[model samples]
Structures are given as C-alpha cells and as structure tokens.
Target chain A: MADFSYYIFCAMLLGGALVVLLSRGYVNAAMGMLCSMLGAAGLMVLMQCYFLAFVMVSVYAGSVLVLFVFVVMLIGDVKENSSIWRKIGIVGLWVVLGAFVGWVSPMLSQAAAGLSKTTEVVFLSQAKNYGLVLMTEFMLPFQIAGALLLAAMIGVMVVAKNPSRKKARRELV
Target chain B: MSYLINQTATCMPALLGTADCSYADMALFIVLKVVFALAAIIVIMCFAALSVVAERKVCAYIQGRYGPNRTAIPIIAAIPLVGNFLKKNGLMQLVADGLKFLLKEDPLPAHVSKLWYLAAPIMSLSPILICACLIPFGVWWDSGGAAHPLAAANIDVSLLAVLAIGALGVYGAIMAGWSSNSKFPYMGAIRASAQVISYELTMALAAMSVVLYMGSVSDSPLSLFEIASAQEQSWFFMTQPLAALLFIVALFAETNRLPFDMAESETDLVSGFHTEYGSFKFGLFFVGEYGHVALGSALFIILFLGAWNPLPYISYPESWGWISTLLGFITFLVKISAMIFFFIWVRWTLPRFRYDQVMALCWKCLMPLALANLVFYMAIAAI
Candidate 1:
C-alpha cells in the first residue's frame, strides 16, 4: 500500500510540476503548480524527510505559486503572447523532458532501495527527532536562514516595488 | 561524510556503554523526529494566534479603544494527558478570532476564475511545511543513552533541499494576487518574486561558508553534528558575526515578515495578493506567514546559534552528561522564542521599506557582503 501511494505521488508531483512549467495560462500553471507542490510534499513524507516535505508545502504551494498568480494579475493583458509558448513548444521541450526523466529515475530508484533496506519504522517519532537536531546540533544554518530572510526582505522592496523605467507595457499571456 | 559522523555518534554509546545503536534504528528515528517538531509548530502557531490579539490590542491602545480583554476564560486545558492543569485564558482567544474568519464572507470577484482563487492560501501554507523536515530538534530521545539522529530525514543534500523549497513560498503570494484577477494583488506578486529570487543567491552562498568549512576539512570531514559539537568554547557567530547578521536579515525578507514585508505593504499593495481572500482560506495564508517565521526562527537556531548548545561562551558544559540532554532541549526552545520575539519587535517598531530600497539592498549590499563573507570564510577555513 505504501509503495503504491509513493508511485502515485511521484507521478503526480513530476507531472503536475511539468505542467506548470510548460503551461501558458498563469492560472492553469499555478493550479498545476499547486498540485505538484502537494504531490512533492507527499513524496517527501514517503521518503521520510517529513520536515522538508512540510516545508515544501508551506513555502512553495503556499507562497510562491500565489505570487506567480499575482504577477499575472498585475501584468494584466500582457499575457496574450502566444508566440512565447509556441517558441518553447517548438524548441527543445523534448530535450527538457528527456533530461528530467533521466535524472529522476535513478534518484527515485536509489531512494526506493534505501527505504527497503531499512526496518523498524516509527514515522512520527522521526519528525520529533528532527526537532531535537535543529534545536541542538545544526544551529548555524538555523541562524543563517534568518539573515537570508532579512536580505530577501530588502530585495523584494527594491526589485518588485522599483518602478520600471519605461511605461508599463502590455501584459504577457 | 555526514553518514560517518552519524555512525560514530551513534556507536559511541555502545562502544563505551550498554545500548545497541544501529543505523537501521537511526533510520526509524526519522519518524520519531517529526513528532517532536509538533511542539515547535504548535508553540509558534500559539504565538501567531496571540499575535492577532497583540496587533488588535496595540491598534486599540493607539486609538483609545478597549480590545480583547474580555475573552479570558478560566485557565484549564481539557485534553487528556498533559491538559489537567489550568491553562492561560483557556488559550481560546485565537479560536474566537479563528471563528470570525470562518464566518466572514469569502468574496471572489467576477473577473477571476474561482478555482485558482480558492486554492491560494492552501498553496501558500504547503511548501513551508516541507522545509521543516530537514531540521533536527534534539538528538534522539530514549532510555538508551546512545547518540540519536536529530532530523526526520537528514539527507546528504539537505541544504539544497532547503534552498529549493524555501524558494517556493513566493508562489503563495504570486498565486493569491494573480488568481484574484485584481490589479494591486498582481503588482504585489511581481514585486515579491523579484525580491525573493534575488536574496536566495546570497542565502545559498552565505550558507556555503559553513558547508565550505565542513567540506574542506580534508583530513576529517565534519558532519553538521561534529561541527556543532566542535564548538567547545564558541558558536560560529563569534567568528562569522557579519555573516550571521546578514543571514538573519535575509531570513526576515525570506519570510515576508513586517518591515521586510513589502510584498503586501498595506499602504500600497492593499492587503497585497490576499486581498480577495477571506475566512479560513485567508487565515491559512496568515498562519502560513507565521509558519514561515517560525520555521525561519528554527533554522536560525540550528545553523548559526550552535543549535542545542546551552551557551556560546561556555563551550562544553561540565553538566553536558546524559542528564543534560533534556535541559538542552528546553534551552533550545527559549532561544527559538527569543528569535521569534525579535521578529515581532521588528515588525512593531519599523516601517515598511519602499520597493526600490529593498531591491538595492539585496543586489548591491547583501550579494556583495555574502560574496566577501564567502571568500573570508574560505580563507580562514583553508588555514
């Protein structure tokens, strides 16, 4: 049952994320992105990295995709540029697909083999253990993530809020 | 290299004492770590709920209106095991506030497609959830006095995982604005993306200093634990204070918290991407933001603060015996809370930044600083 769910989640994650990457409509892409994020989180859970999985859900699906949709709204009618999608479609999409498949398969297989190698599973306890380590041992990265946030804060105000030099052009589709 | 450290750490107890410490058992520990993280999550969520009250009371105090003084109930927790004691105001103020959110109108404008609009908050909250897994709270906790694994999944590439997932929080803001099909939210989203992506590089490189130090130790590569344990007399902050400061600032920006919260500056963005959302869905985004804050604080605790070490100046505590692990866990919480409180204090004290200044700081200031910090770290580590 667990293996079955794992496969389903991985397929959805990869497929949904790719849909987001490839789709023209920002809304459709965001939707696909949302599903992919959830799927990714689920996969992380299956892989036993519960903390990373939850963070993926909290940060990506929760914040990033919302921002993407927001950008579309701000840009408005600028999105009608069918030529961009056509260009991507006409170009090396197959190559991107092939590369993705090539990378994911082996990692997934390794993770699968690693999981089967272990026994004595205590799922929730691992999350708790993660708490202890973050608190005690790996304290530096803990602090650095904070400084990163501050800089990012300053960056957003400058980049997103900085007005464009030229007139606001038409929105891209 | 991390694995070797983990093996040595685990086997130390059996090598010296009596418990059977095995890697397979350590793997089971991944699940155990996740359960303990619930306290951190619950603690912060409890505070964020209180933050709503804090925000309201402050607003009222400024306007001379009475606020939230009436909701205090007889302090008693009703739950089974630990809930027998009288609690604080029943801790129900947030619940009351949460109910209001649920009853409020959830309005999606006619111009927007309903599907994307409804999905924004959940989407926003989801990714931050995944990032928490790599964090190790306390070494393992059990009867056997063996060294325990800390995180749920301590993958070799957790730094990469953190960077990749932390980058995702931008989506929630972007999605909320775009799906609403509103003008202001959309603008908020675009600003958010540029701001977020720019700082990410600095964050990654700033982190690289430690990784470089650890990775470069050719004679004996330090696991995160060993590096953590190595600080007998000092935290890395003493040597890399500038980088530590830089990282904290970046973390605030990373989480879109106040002063740094340009993504949804109230004066201009008009609630930003989430303007169209209401009730629990909106609450999800709000809580998610706090969740980001909480996770960021936790990360700060682990990476630069010397993690579970009780004090930076003391090095190894004389009492750091089998009994001290429990105290280490408690002290860790206090540190995290202190950090979280700093976030709130900054939010209350500072005004929001103008978008231009925010961008200029990241590219011009932080990026350069981060690069310089990297060079310095490498130079010193090389010696």
Candidate 2:
C-alpha cells in the first residue's frame, strides 16, 4: 500500500508539472501548480514529516497560489503572444535544465543508494523538533531568510506607493 | 488463507460470520471508517440546512414578520400535534427548500466558463467536509476511564490541517467569480480572495496565541483534542479574551458573514462571486457557507468554549461511560447551535461595512491587535 501510494503521488507530481508546462490558461496553470504542491506534500506525509507537509500546503499552496490566482484574475485574461525570441529563450532554458538534470541524476542516484544502506533514517515528525532545529543549528540562516522576507515586503510597499504623490506632498511642504 | 482467516477471527471475534474471509477485518475497518466520515458529513450538512431555516426565522422574529411558516407536506401536515409544531416552526420548509433546489431547472449561462462553473461548488463544499473530519465533537470514555475524542481522524497537527484545508476554500469563490465572465462576479472574486487572505493571517495569529498558551499547559498544543482536554479546568476565553475576540472577528470575515461580507454585498454586487450560479449550484454555495459557519463554531467551542465540557471547571465524569459521551455530544451540539444563533443575530443586527473600511479594519486594526495578543501570550508562556 505504501509503495502503491508513493507511485500514485509520483504520477500526480509529474502529471501536474506536465499540466503546468502545457496548459494555456493562467488559471489552469495555477491549479496545476496547486496539484503539484499537493503531490509534493503527499510525498512529505509518506516520509512521515507531517508538520512540514502541512506547512507546505498552508504556506505555498494556500497563500502563495491564492495570491497568484488573485493577481491573474485582477490582470484579466490576456493571451500572451509568443514572440520568436521568447520561443527561442524557452527552448534554450529547457536545454539548460535538461543538461543540469543529466549532470545531477547520477550523483542523486548514488546518494540514494548510499542512503538505503544506512539502517536508520532520522525524520523530524514534531513541530517542536523543527523549532528546536531552527532555533539552534539553523538559527542564523533562518533569521537571515526572515530578514530577507522583511526586506522584500518593505520593498513592495515602497514600490507600490505612488512616488508622484510623495513628490507632490514634499512640494506642498 | 484459512490459517490467515483463523488467526484474524481469533483476534477479532466480532467477524465470526466472516471467519472464512481473508481481508474481512481490514474491509470492515475501512467500511466503518467511511461510514463514520459519511455520518459526520451528513450531520454537518443537516446543520447547514437547518441553519438556513433558523436564519430566516430569526430574521423574521427580529423584523416582526412571519417567515415560511406555511410550507408543509401533505399527509405530514394532516397529522396531530407533531405536524402542527413542525408547521409552526417552519421545519417543513427545509424539505421544501431542498426539493426546490433539487427539482428546479439548473441553468447554464452562455457567457460563463462551463468547466470552472461546474467545479467551483464542489471545490467550495469539499474543504469544509474535509475539515469536519478533524473536529473532536465530543469525548468517548473507555472502560479504563481514558478519554478519546469522537472524531473521524485525530491527528497530531489537526489544527494546522484545518487551517490548510480551510484556506483552500478561496479557490471556489475565485473560480466562481472568474468563470462567470461578468463584472460584478469578477469584482466579488477579487474582494473574496483579498478578504480571505487578509483575515486568514489574523485568524492564524489569534489561534497561535491560544496554541502558545496551550503549549505551556498541554502536551500537544497543535492538536484540537489536546487543546480541548487542556480546557477541562478552565476555558481559554476567560484567559485569552483578546485572542478569542480576534479569532471571532476573523472567523466572521473568513466565512464572509456580515458586517464583513463585502464579497456578496447585495446592494453593490448582485450576488457577488455566485452571481451567475443558479439552482442546485447556488444551493451548494449556500450550504458551503453555512457548513463553514458550523465548522467554525465547532472549532471556536473546542478552542475557547471548552469543547464537550459543559461549563468552566465542570467536566464529564469518566465513570458515566457512554452516557457521558452522549451528554458531551449533546452539549457540543447545543453550544454550536447557540454560536450559529449568535452568527444570525449579529448578521441581522449589524449593517455591512464599506469594502475599504473592511480592508482598513482588517489591516490597520485587527492585524496589529492579533500580533499584540500573540506577543502577550508568548510572554506569558515564557514566564
């Protein structure tokens, strides 16, 4: 049953990614992304990392994808005219991605083989364990990531604010 | 196979009739689980349907008018006191409304995207049904006097699961609005996504405060069952009033109830995201809203109102066995009914806020308040 579920989730992940790559509509693409995220989360659950799985669903699929759909709707349905340069760029990107994957696959398979040799696989199942790891070993990296997010938020606020209005207010003063 | 069956039968004597079967125990377990889940869904859906009638009746009573007191079945209406009582309370209207939705012509508009229009209602209702599985409705005490939550799936991170599943409900509204291909619905969808996203933060933050407090008092703070069990001596509302208040307000917004129901504000937007929906499709959206309300109320009860516990400092005696479980379930139902009534009362009493005001209140007022509440609880937890 576990292996069967693993294969099913793998199919879902690949199928969803294919849909994201091939779908025309922005909404369809977003939904495809959601399906992919759910598949990944399912795999995470299968790995017994329940806390991370739920966090993935809540943070990425829930909030981020909703925002993506929101923006897509707000922008209205406009078909992107695939210019020649864009088509070329897409092909070039795919070639690079394929080459990178080709380079990494052997090493990944080797690592997996080595990992299978190890009897015990440590997995963080509890939120407290995750908290402890973040606060201790990963403290600096986590804090830096948080600060980066803060900076990005402030940047958005700054960019979103009307510069002309600010200038006008300054002139009035 | 015979040996397998014999081994299983010896361990599980309840399946004596299926003693010859190989996977009888596993099949029975799966079937029983599915049945329990279906029962939970049916109960929630029934509550949603009844709450519709309750909303109408409450609105009528408040406005000094009779609402749907005449809809009655043929033979059932001819019966004695029971029929009269049902007629007087407009209980039969539930049947009438349901049949009307089912039997009515399901119209498909030319302008709308058919696929998304079809999918939206299912998307809306399924999340609520899924979340219902995580709620610890009441406690069932075993012979050993240990308490077990009467839930479909009692997981460690059920609270997070609820929030994650609940957040996906936005897709239904967004899809409904976007697929309608109309101005009002598009606007409503925009409003819905924004409103849901904004209030979700406050809701999570508020719940986090409770979680923080629960961490100090309980073993597993993230589990709804643990949260409820921790509140056996004292309800969280007494201690975490501000978090409770914030959570309640966020709940109102998240469910798109008044005065925060800018998505479907009838005056401005005809029916908001569901403007193009008709017949059973519209009914699904209606039921989904009430289902959210029902689940949200149950969650609130679990979090702040002490779950199956009757009152503050008062708990069900484990020695009473199944009777205690029955009483606990009844108490839970009664509490949820009162919360639903409170939802209706507030809806009828308060006027809708302007969209800008709603956003402003969420960001400027509620967000900061929720953050402060979280900080306060964090400090308390630290001490």
Candidate 3:
C-alpha cells in the first residue's frame, strides 16, 4: 500500500515537474512548481523525515513560494509567457536531473536494503543534524548563500526605494 | 525498534475490537476529555453568539422598537401542549443568521486569486484538527501494566510538533486576506501576521519553560505523565506562577480572543481577513477561532492545572487504575470547562485592545516578562 502510494506520488511529481518545464503559461508553471514541492514533501514523509517534510511545507510553501507568487504577480508579464529560447535553455539541466534520479533511486534502495540491518529510523529526526551539516560540512557554501541573500535584499531595496540614488542618477543623466 | 514492533502488535487487539475501528473511536473515548478541554470554549462561543443576539434585542427594547419575535420557529419547543406558545422568536435567529450567510453571495472580488481564497478556509480547518491529535485525552497501558500515552501522534517531539501545527492555523487567515485582493483583506492579513507571530513567541516561550522544566523534572521514562506527576504534590504554577499567567494570556492572544482581537476589529477592518467570506468558507474561520480557543484552553489545563488530577495529591502508576482514570478524565474535562468559561467571561468583560496597544503589551510587557520568568526558573533550576 505504501509502495503503491509512492509510485503514484512519483508519477504525479514527475508529471508536475514536466509541466513546470513545458507549460507555456506562467500560472500553470507556478502551479506545477507547487505540485512538485508538495510531492517532494510527501516523499520526505514516506522516507520517515516527518519534521523535514513539515518544515518544507512551512518554509518552502509558506514563505518561499509565497514570495515567488508575489514576485510573479508584481512582475505581471501575464501572457502565456513561455518562449522557445528559455525552453531549450534548460534541456541539459533537465537531462542531468533525470539521469541522477534514474541512477540514484536504485542505489538508494540497495543501500537501504543493506542498512535494513541496523533498523533505527533516525532520518531527519534531529534539527541539529541539518544544522551541524550546514555549519560544518557545507560551512563556506552556507555562509556564501547567506551573504548572497543579504546582498540581494540590500540591492533590491536600494534599487527600488533609495530616493538619493534616484536623485543622483537623475542629476548624472 | 522492538518497541515500534510491539506497539504495532498491541494495536492488533485494538483493530480487532471493531472492524469499524477508527481515529473516531480514539476520538470518542476522548469525549469526556474534549468536553473538559472545550467546555469553556463551547460556553463562550455560545454566549458570544448569544450576546450578539442579545445586543440586538437590548437595543430594540430600549428604543421602543419591535424585535423580530415574529419569525421565531420552534426547535423542539419546550412549552407544554401548544407548540405555538413554545415558539422561539425566530429561535432560528442563529439559523437565520447562518442561512443568510449561506445564501449570501460569496463576494470574491475580481482582484483576488480564486485558488488561495478557496484554499484558505480548508487550510484554517486542517491545522486546528492536526493540533487536536496531539492532545492526551486518556492514557496508554501495556499488557505488563506499564502506562503508555493517550495522544494520537505521540512523537517524542510532540511538544514542538503541537506548536508547529498550531502555528499553521494563522496561514489560513493570512492567505484569505492576501489572496482576496482587497485593502481590507490585505490589512487584515498584515494584522494577523503581526499578531499571530508576536503572540506565538510568548506562547512558545511559556510552553518551552515547561518543556525545559520537564527535562529538569525527569530524564528517562519521561512522558507528559511525568510532567503531571512531577506536579503530584504541587502544580508547576505554584513554583512558576508568572510563567503560568504569561502562558494563559499568550494562549488567549494566540487564539485571537478579545483584547488581542485586532485582526478582527470589525469596526476598523470589516471582519478583518475574512470580509469577503460567506457560507461555509466563512464558517471555517469562525470555527477555527473557537477551535484555537478550545486547543489553547486544553493546553492551559494540561500544563498548569495538573491535567486530570483533582488535586496535586496522587502519585505513581499504581494509583492510576481504571476508575481513577475515568475520574481523572472527568476532572480534566471540568478543568477545561472552567478555563473555557474564564475565556468567555473575559471576552464579555473586557473591551478590545487597539492594535498598537496589543503590540505594545505583547512586545514590551509579555516578551520581557517571559525572558525574566525563564531566567528566574533557570536560576532556581541551577540552585
């Protein structure tokens, strides 16, 4: 029963991701992105990463996708706004992801089968695991990501809301 | 690992007890518990609604105006033989109000995203139900006579899990307002986000103190039972009265009751986030509000009131027999009712706080007070 649900979820996920890549309409694409995110969260739950699944729902769905939708609306280029160039642009990335999932899933199951001996399901149970992993193993990358987000936020605020910059630019022009 | 297997094995007896066995069975067994938890809330909501009618009646009677007693219908009219004498003054006053809402057009203005507008109510309802699942209604016992937990989803991380689930209820309001594509919805959403997030901190901090204290109180075989048992001779509030007080206040605000009802300051924002909602969609927000009140009341009773204990008198696994369990369950329900009544009473007595005052009280009054309370508790624990 679990496996049946897993396969059905997988099908829906892939279909949604495919739609995200293929859909001409931005609305449809955004909807597809949400479906894919939801499917990923579902898979995390199935893998016994319940807390991570919930955090994914809370953070990605609640905050990140909300921002995404808000930005899409704010940008308001609402024509079935897919172009041939952008479609072709992501084919290599799609192929790579497809290849990775196809190869990794079997390897994961094989590894899981071997480790079925230990029998302790500690998958994503501890917040500290992700925190420690972020701080230690991926320290530089995480720091860099934080720096980038801060810089981007400042840049956006400056470009959009800085009155002096607008005056300075106007004077310069 | 064996524990999980053993639990699944034990569940066989439960599953075999009825083919129609369900979460509902577990849910029904908690009936007395739910009443204890929700009694005050049911009373308050009933009264809060009744007060709305009473306010109208009072206004009419005072001004020499005829109220709509003509439309009264008998819902199991209590008057003796003649059904007409027992006629309710459109006793379906609530029904009429309900039908008006149901038949009233759901005014989804062109500006709103239809999907989120529709999804908001469902979202509102889901988290409230999920929060209920973690509430310990009774107890679990093994065949060896060891006590087990009564909560549906008894994750070791249930304290934090319940908090997280409870927080999700805010999203429904947020989305309802933001997706509605109107100033009222937008303003309501902003108020909701600010209030929910603000009160959430104090609520969490207050709850966290207990969680931390629980760690100090017990190390292994640690259940909510332990938390209650730790208070066997004395409730936590006696030791941490300030924390308990902070918690209930936060609970009320967290549920968006009066005094913290800036989100639904209808005079200002027109039903706040749900101005556009009508029918069952509107009902979700309505019931969700009461549900939060119920859940908050339950948590308050559990944490501070020593759960189902009549006094902080009894201790040990042996003392918790079937009859005691039944009595404990009743005692718990009565506590919940008392808390809920207190909530309703407060609503009637106290007026709404202005948005600025609400924010100021939470940030300036509650937050600092919570920090100090935590430090005091920590100091005591250290000693």
Candidate 4:
C-alpha cells in the first residue's frame, strides 16, 4: 500500500511537471506548479520529513505560487506564438532528457534498492532536531544563506526605489 | 515512516482490531481516519450554516430589527413555544437559506473560465477541512487515566500543517477572481492575494512566539495537542498578550472578515471574487468563508483560550472518565461558539479598512509588532 501510494505521488509529480511544461495559460501553468509542489510535499511526508513537507507546501505552493498567479493576473494573458524551430528544439530537448533518464534509471534503481537495506538512516522527525542541526552543525551555511537573502532583498529595494523622483524631491526642497 | 505508522497504530488499537497490530489494521486505521475526517467536515459545515443564521440574528439585534423571523416551513411553524422560539431566533432561516442554495439554478457565466470557475469553491473549502483535522477539539480520557485528543489526525507538526494548509486557501479566491473574467473580481482577487501574502508573515511570526513559549514549557511544542495541554495552568493569551493580539488581528485578515475584507468588500468590489458566481457556486464560497471563520476561531481557542480546559488554572478531573470527556467537549464547543460570536460581533461593528490602509496596517504596523513580540518571547525563553 505504501509503495502504491509512493508511485501515485511520483506519477503526480511527473504529471504535474508535464502539465507545467505543456500548458499554454499562465494560470494553468501556476496550478500545475502547485500540483507539482504538493506531490513533492507528499514524497517528503513519505520520507518522514513532515516539517520540510509542510514548509514546502506553505512557502512554495502556498505563498510563492500565489505571488506567481498574482503577477500573471496583473500582467494579463498574452499568447506568445513560438517559431516552429523553437517547438522542434523543445521536442529534441524532451527526447534527450528522456534518453538521459532511461540511461540513469538502472543505477538509480540499484541505489534505491541498496538504500532499503541500510538500518541506520538519519531522520529529523521533530522540528527541534532541525533547529538543533541548523544552530550547531550548519550554523555558518545557514547564516550565509540568510545573509545572501538579505543582500538580494536590499538589491531589489534599491532597484525598485525611484532614484530620479528622490533627486527631484531633494532639488525641490 | 515506520515510527509514524507504529505510533498511529498504537494510538487507537482498540478501534482498529486486536491487541496484535498488523498490516490489515493499518487499512482499518485509514478507514477510521477517513470517517473521523468526514465527521469533522460535517461538524464544521453545520457550524458554518448555523453561524450564517447567527450572523443575521446578531446583525438584526445590533441594528434594532428582527432578522429572518418570518421564514419557516409550515410543519415547523405549527409547533407551540418551540416553533416561536426557533422562529424568533431565526433558526429556520438556515433551512430556508440552504434549500434556496440547493434548489436555485447554478449559473455559469459565458465570459468566465469554465474550469477554474468550477474548481475555485472546492479549492476554497478543502484547505479548511484539512486544517480542521489537526485541531484537538477536546480530550477523551480512557479508563487507565491517559488522555487522547479528540482529533482526526494527531500529527507532530500540526501547527505548521494548519498554517501551510490554511495558506493554500488564497488560491481559491485568486482562481475565482481571475476566472470571473470581470474587472471587479480581478481587482478583488489581486487585493486578496496581496492581503493574504502580507498578513501571513505577521500571522506566522505571532504564532511562532506562541510556539516558542510552548517550547519552553512543553515537550512537543509544535503539536497542537501538546500546545493545548501545556496551557493547563494558564492560556498563552495571558502570557503572550501581544502575540495573541497580533494573531487575532492577522486571523481576521486571513479569514477576510470585516475591517480587513478587501477581497469581497460589497461596496466597491461588487461581492468581490465571487462576483460572477451565482446560486450554488456562490453558496459554496459563502459556506467556505464561514468554514474558514469557524476553523480560525477553533484555532484561536486552542492557541490562546486553553482548548478544552474550562478556565485558566482549572483542569478537568481525570478520574471522571467519560463524564470529564463530555464536559471537556462541551467546554470546547462553548469556547468555539463564543469565539465565533466575537467574530460576528466584530464584523457587524467595524467598518471595512481602505485597500491601502489594509496593506499599510499589515506591513507597516502588524509585521513590526509581530517581529518584536517574537523577539521578546525569545528573550524571555533565553533568560
């Protein structure tokens, strides 16, 4: 039953991604991405990472996708007509991706089968364990990520600010 | 994963099967969970329906008029004092309104996007139902004196689950507005998405403070059941008043209640996201809104009002068994009703905030306040 559910989630993830790739409408694409995120969260739950799963749903599917749709709605629906060459290129890319996956499948399956034999797998079931690891073991990396985010936010703020308007106000004053 | 499965299996072995838990028992467990989920959804839907009646009655009382007192079926209207009381309280209006929604023609506007227009109401309601399973409404004490939460799912990260699931409700509004293919709905959807996104930060931060406080006091701080149980001595509202205040304010915004109802402000947005939606679809949205309100109230009760506990510092007697459980459930129901009443009262009393004002309040005021509250709680925990 568990394996059946896992396969279902996998199908959902791949199907959603396919929908995202193929859908023409922006809202449809966003919804597809939401489905993909939910599938990924389900997989995380199967892996016993409940905290990570919920975070993925809340942050990515919930907030980020909402923002994506918000932007899409604000921009309005614009149908883009791609050249035939571009379509051919996408088909070629899909073939190459499928071939690559086919080539890697056996090794991936072998690794996954080996993983089942491992008795001791590190599991962060509780939220505290995640906090402990972030604070102690991964403190520097976490801090660096935070700093990077802050820097990006500052950059966006600077870019968004109307510098000419500020200068004009200063001159007027 | 095995641990989670085993934990669930052990939690309710009596309901599942024999003492020896097996694979088939897990299937039974899933069925039991589904039944519980359905029950929770029914309870929530009923509350939502009744709250509509309560809202009308409350609004009438506030405005000095009788609301829906005349709407009643003949059979029900023929009763003596009971019928008059029911009519006076506008209880039968619920039945009439429900029948209207059911019997009315569900119209699909020509201009609207067919798929999303149909999907939006279901999307709006499912998240609330999912979150409802996480709430520990009351505690059931067994013969051995051990207490089990009267909830559908007792997951460890229930608080996070609730927040995450609840946030997805924005999609419903967004979809409804966008699919409507009308300017009013589009504007309402935009406002809703922006408002939800803005207020979500404050809501998370405020809830985080409560989580932090619970962490210091309890074993499993992230679990809703544990959080409720931790408040056996005093509710979080007393200890973390600022956080509670921020949470309540954010809750109002999140649920799109009056004073923060930028989504469906009837004055400007022409009923907002559900502008093009009529009949049953509109009814679904209506019920979904109230469901969100009801669940939000239940969440507030669990977080700040001490869940099933009758009052602060007063714990239910473990020795009383089923009677204690009954009392706890009653207490929980009463608390939820009071919280719902408070929601309705505020809706009737307060005027809607301007769009820009709502945005400014969320980002400029509530966010900073929530952040400070979290920091203060962190400092207290550290000390």
lDDT tens digits, residue span B270-345, model 1:
8887877777888998888877877787767666887777887653243455446666666666777777777777
Give all TM-scores, in the order shown: 0.67, 0.91, 0.69, 0.92
Q: What DockQ was computed for model 2? A: 0.38
Please identify which of the two predictions, 2 or 4, would achieve the higher DockQ against the true structure: 4
Clashing pairs in 4: none
TM-score of candidate 2 against the unseen true structure: 0.91
List, residue by residue over B189-294, the lDDT tens digit for candidate 2. Answer: 9999999999999999999998888777666678999999988898999989998999999999999998999889999999999999999999999999999999
Following a full C-alpha superposition, what root-mean-square deviation does model 1 have from the true structure?
Answer: 11.0
Candidate 1: regions farther than 4 A off: A1-6, A17-27, A30-173, B1-44, B50-67, B74-92, B140-146, B216-227, B230-232, B315-322
Instruction: Return the clash pairs for model 3, or none.
Output: B36-B333, B40-B340, B40-B341, B71-B90, B72-B89, B72-B90, B140-B148
Question: Backbone collision count in every prediction?
Answer: 154, 0, 7, 0
lDDT, each prediction = 0.67, 0.87, 0.68, 0.87
Model 3 CA lDDT for position A100? 97
- Residues B1-383 of candidate 4 have per-residue lDDT tens digits of 23334557674543323244556766667777788888888878888988999999889999999788887778877899998888888898898888899899888889888999999999998899898888887887655556678888888899999999999998999999999999999999999999999999999999999899878766668899988888889898998898889999999999999999999999998899999988888888999999999999988888888999998999888888778888998899888889989999999999999999999998889998998888888998899
The TM-score obtained by chain A of candidate 1 when compared with the true chain A:
0.62
Query: Candidate 3 — which residues are off by over 4 angstroms?
Result: A5-44, A49-95, A101-173, B1-7, B10-75, B79-111, B140-143, B218-230, B314-320, B375-383
What's the TM-score of chain A alone for every prediction?
0.62, 0.78, 0.67, 0.80
Candidate 2, residue B162: Cα displacement in angstroms equals: 0.5
What is the descending DockQ order?
A: 4, 2, 3, 1
